[model samples]
Target: MNDMLQVARREIKTGFRNPWAYSFLILFCVFSLCLLVINSQSIVQGYSGVTGSMLSLILYLLPLMTLFLGSFSLTAEKEEGSWQLLSTYPIGSLSFIVGKYIGLSIVLLTIVAFGYGLMGVISGLVGMSFDSTTYVLFIAFSCGLVLLFLTLALLIGSLSKNRWQALTVSVSIWFFAVIGWQTILISVLNFLPYTWIKPTLVALTFINPAELVRLFVVIKLGGGSILGPEYYQWVDWIQRSSGSWLFIAVCMLWISFSIMVVYWLWERGRSHG
Candidate 1:
């Protein structure tokens, strides 16, 4: 536990020391604040609902932030030959993996928290205080989405041989997870001759972080009535039963799969070398 924490601390320090890392944070903050301000203005003008509109802004930004920050974590280390340095320590491979995740998760969470805080302040100024329950739900589920993205990127980084490939693959996966699923769903329902596309789509929802986050957000914030009735109905059902459970289940699957893939790749690299 102590060693893992040390590793996490070192990772955090390295992030701070890197110029690109600091730049990402600054850019994210500026973009997020601008988005909140723009959307809140539209909401006040009776153009959109606070919850749905704010959530839409977050949905757009979160995936981009996740992809950029996480895609290079392991890949950069591998490129610089620093990844092997950790192996000299007594930490188990699993501990090293977990430590890396912990460090990245903290950084991502800080970004999310900052964005949420900025949004919340603006919403409050517009006389829109978040319901305690709904706020908690939104944060929890969104964090779950972040965890899913982080794990997937880590796996991609471990698998790819270089930073460029890792970045390309990671961004591609992020695109699919964030928006490609929605495009594909629309096309599938339109092109395919399936009467039960809803059920199939619901199944696909488990793998779609953007959809899951949006569902929880819409249900809590009251959909801008932006979603079709079908999506709203599904969100209502998930809300009634427990979206948190589903979020946890999906996140666990992503984390476990990532761990397995990273471990396998690490072994393969060692053996081939």
Candidate 2:
């Protein structure tokens, strides 16, 4: 436990010192403030077009930012031989990875919070009305994006042999997960039987954290109807009293499963070579 905390503290220090961290920080802050432009439009109740667009904007940016930041940090350790040095210590792989996760989560979440906070403050100064509930939910959505996607980033980092490899895989994943998921899902589902589509879609939704979190947040915002009529039944079930809890359960499962895989892979690499 002490070793894990030490690793965590070390990650925190290095994460902030990394220049890529600050570059992402600046980009997110600039993009976040652009929400004011969308706010200029009239607000409709319940996940207004304005808010929905904002959600999409955030979905596009945060996951990639997280993937790059997390992946590069891991890959750099390997490339610089720091990971080899760390392995020489008494600490285990689980402790090191979990510690990195803990520290990176803090660093990324802080950037997320600061970006939104700056946006809120600027909007206030400009006399724009951003709803408190909506503000809170969007922040939650962004934080969820950061936390969930960071796991994926760590996994990519673990798999990559170098920063270049990590960067390539990260972009590929961000493209497929965030940008191309819907089209690919539709095309692939067509090959399945009619009876299989619904369940398959549900299963696939859980496979990608980006889709899962976005869908849950949309439902929580009472905008599930915008997902189109095909999702009506599933969305209805999720809107039930315990639906959010169910979503939370899936998220917990995803984190556990992914972390286990990452740790398993890392420990395997350590053993093999």
Candidate 3:
């Protein structure tokens, strides 16, 4: 535990030294503030309207930022031969990866907290009523989405032989998760039997952390108003299945699955080398 914490501290320090981290944070803050200011009229609906809009923004941006950060962090170490040097020390591979994840998660969470907190403060100042419970859930779920993508990014980094490869793959994944997946799903839904569409959509939501996060937030903010009536049934089904906890569990599953894949790939490469 102590060693893991030390590794986490090292990663945190390294992240702080990087200009990209600061840039990402600044961009997030600026965008969040702008969003709040622009949607000032909608703030009368409480946090739900604002949070829904922010969820859309987060769905698009957070995955890309996390993917780039996590991929580069690992690939840079490998390129500089630092990972090899570190292996000579007492740290195990699991500890190193977990620590890095922990450190990155902390950084990401801090960014989310500050950005949302600022939004809350601004909304309050503008006389927007507070929905503290809903606001807190939105922040928590957004952080969970970040952790999911971070794990995925590390897996991509571990699989790639170099930084360029990792970057390319990571961007591809971001594109798919953010844009391509939805396009494909929509096209497929048009052709699927009416009976199959709902179940398929539900399954797809579980498979994609981005979609799942959006759904989770939508449900928490009180059902399918944001997504229209087409999705209300899906939301109802999730509610029946006790979906809030289920969604959280599935997100944790994504993190675990990605980490397991990274460990396997890392071990295989080490053995071969």
Candidate 4:
């Protein structure tokens, strides 16, 4: 546990030292702020009332940044031969992975929280109101999504041999996860026979976490009064739909399988050598 904490601290310190990470965070925050300003008018018109939309935006989009950071995490160390040094230490792989995850999540969460504040400013400008409970739920949802994305990114990082390969895989995964499903859904609708459309959509969406998050959020925002009795429904929907438990279950399955695959590949590479 102590070792993991130390490793996590090292990862966090290294991340802070990296110029690209800081630059990316700044740029993302700036762009999100711009979007909030533009949407402020919509809020006044009652079209943009989701209290957590800004934070949610940051949570969804931060996957790209998280991917880049995480993919580079181990691959860069490996390329520099630093991973060899760590391996020689009294460090466990699980400690290394979990530590890096914690450290990086802290950094990402800070950036998203800042975005949430920027969002609150937009809400105020638009004259929309949200009580304390809604604010908590929004933050909780954002945290869960951020962890889910970063975990996948870390797994990709562990698998790649070099920074470039890691980056390619991470970005490709992000592209497919974020946009590929939508494209597939559209194609299924337009090209497939009518009978197959709904089934295709259901299968694609049911398995796709991104779509689930969006679906859950849209329904929550549109289906209730922000400050009224129906607020519990929105809260309940978010809690269930945040998919934290499901995501953790999926990640555990993914990691267990991934570790087996990586070990097999490692053994094969050694045998070949």
Q: Largest TM-score belongs to which candidate?
A: 2
Minimum summed lDDT over a 10-residue window in model 1 is located at 39-48
RMSD after CA superposition, every candidate = 3.6, 1.4, 2.8, 6.1
Worst 10 residues of 3 by lDDT: 41-50
- Prediction 3 TM-score vs. true: 0.87
Model 4, runs deviating above 4 Å: 42-60, 118-141, 186-207, 223-273
TM-score of each: 0.80, 0.95, 0.87, 0.70
Choose 3 or 4, whichever is better by lDDT: 3
lDDT of 1 at 178: 65
**Candidate 1: tens digits of C-alpha lDDT, residues 42-153:** 3332223555555565666667667666767788888888867866667766677778888888887876677667777777787753456556655765686687777777
How far does residue 136 in candidate 4 sit from its true spot (Å)?
5.7
- Give per-candidate clash totals: 0, 0, 0, 0
Stretch of 10 with least lDDT, candidate 2: 40-49
Candidate rank order under TM-score: 2, 3, 1, 4
Candidate 4 lDDT over 1-273, as tens digits, reads: 998899889988998888867787787678656655655454322215444455445544666777888778867876898767877788766676667778888877877687678767777776755454445555555655666667666667666888889888977877777757667666667987867765666566545555545445444444334433423543454557554466457545644554454445434533453
Ranked by lDDT, the better of candidates 1 and 3 is 3
Candidate no. 2 TM-score: 0.95
lDDT of each candidate versus the true structure: 0.69, 0.88, 0.79, 0.64
Backbone clash pairs for candidate 1 read: none
Which lDDT tens digits does candidate 2 get at residues 143-212? 8888889889999999999999999999999999999999999999999998998899888988888998
